[model samples]
Target: MVGAGIGGLCAAAGLQRAGVEVVVLERADEVRSGGSGLSVFSNGIRALDALGVGDAFRAVTTRTEGLRAGQRRPSGAWLSTLPADAVAELRVIDRADLHGLLSDAVTAGTVRTGRRVTSMYPNGLVESVGSGTAGARRAWDRFDLVIGADGLRSAVRTGWPEDPGVAYSGYATWRGITAAPVELRGEAGETWGVECRFGIAPLADGRVYWFGVRTAGIDEPGDPALLRELFGSWHRPIPELIDATDPAAMQYLPIEELSGDLPTFARGRAVLLGDAAHAMTPDLGQGGGMAMEDAATLVGLIAPFAGTECGDAPELLDEALRRYDELRRPRPQRVAARSRMIGRLAHAPGPLLCAARDLVVRATPAAALGRQAAWVHEWLLTR
Candidate 1:
């Protein structure tokens, strides 16, 4: 595994559990100790269950009751409320907590931090900066199968020369977590307006995770004061949440999506997974969830070859990668497109369009949304 982020660590957990000898190399000096919270939907939980860490994850995370959507009225009120009962039960967790859980699940010494992978060959050979080596020294290591669980800026993907670059979405996002006062309590909710949206999900310990998104117009740097000036007038408690957050804790990410139509996930013994393959918009909160699903699927597909003779392993690995891509591609693409579309709709500027959107939200049956999400959450692991 290259890149010991969430995807890499989860991949390590899954492959190690399947009796595969795995070593994870991470470029960072340590697991990122701070990050925005995540919404782990039931589908993702199911994937964690398959990896045997669902319960452990649940122990540290808060299972969300559902989502509530509304519009901020000009009169400082909220209008057009809709609940998330239509979707599967979801949980909100801090990213640090999730990373810690995944890291703990893997055996000691399986992961090496600060060892950056500089390049990879087609035949599963990886070159990386050795420990204490100065000025980009090259060292080689080979594996029967190489899983690139590296993130969006993946060196492994670049090394293949087969992958395309990331395409920027027309939006950027600001995410942060604040300690929700003991008095305020609720499930997750989102407030929509012309060309802007804000979502808030409460963690188990009363810290509320919130995200603010708007259409990225150009290369302007993020201005938190401007964000507060723009969104401070939304519905109740949102202002409070924003005020509670420390300015330094906020993270700004320019949205980007995968545009290449890569036919195969592998070149020789190398395979890519997670953000290395599909880094989609977080509009649907499925980015991390999809990565977890990929990790689980890769393990199930490759387990049979763990102890098989060396000659047969390469063929089996190739077949597994083929199947993995086939199963994963459609769902993530559907999600990526849907998320982008929804974000566009939410950010529509015209009063008529906003009104029409509210009308649809008010009229659309929650059950319909539930059914759509069920298709995503109800994935059964195949042996």
Candidate 2:
């Protein structure tokens, strides 16, 4: 396994639980101790269950009834609201807390920190810069399989000729958490504007997690003051939440996703997973969830290869990987496409287009919206 982010760690947990010997290669010195937060839907919850960490995750996360989104005028009147039932059984977890959970679930000593993999070969040989060795690179022991759980710019994916490339989504996002002040209490939801959006949700503790997104250049810099100037007058808790955040804790990121023409997620003995395979827009909040699903699905498909007495282990492994690619590829790509379409519609640039977008949302019944979203949140792990 390469890269110890959410997807890689979860994959390690599932693979280890199946009695497979595993080692995770991460470039960071240690597991991330702090970061923003994430919202996981029922589908992600089910993936956690498949990985045997569902209870551990619930212990540190706050469960919400559903997802609610609406558009507001700059003056703060509701243009339209997606019904609360649109997304059922939602939960929010601080990224650090969830990372700690997955890290603990992995067998101790399996993760090698501060090691950067320079390249991986088709025969499962990984070359990495050894930690504290003054940048000396060496080949690690070969393995039966290699998983490219690395994020968007994955080394393993780059080594293969099949990779198409990555594309900029033309948007940027700022996320942070603040201690919930006395005035904030209630359900969680998102407020959308012409080309911008703000989301708010409560953590298990009293802190509230929020994110602000807008259409912008990929190289644009982010400023908290600019966020205030843009959204300060829009709504009551929105500005207040921004004001309450610790300035240093704010994180800014430019959104990007895999090209729609990504070739194959698998090549030879190595395979890609998570953002390495299908990076998607955050418009639907399923980026992390899809990665979790990928982890669970990958491990579930390959379990038979662990400690098998069959003579043709290599052929069996190849078949399992073929099945993994066949089963896992289409759904996430479809979801990515849907998320991109939603982002384009929500960030429509012209006044006439924005008004039409809001009008269509208002005219559409809540039940109809819920039905359209049901396919996303209703996913469950087969294992």
Best by lDDT: 2
lDDT of 1 by residue, 290-323 (tens): 8888888888898877878778776787888888
Cα error, residue 187 of model 1, in Å, equals 4.5
Query: Where does model 2 exceed 4 Å of error?
Result: 66-71, 131-134, 181-185
Clashes of each: 1, 0
Model 2 pairs whose backbones collide: none
Worst 10 residues of 2 by lDDT: 179-188
Task: Report per-prediction Cα RMSD to one decimal.
Answer: 2.5, 2.0
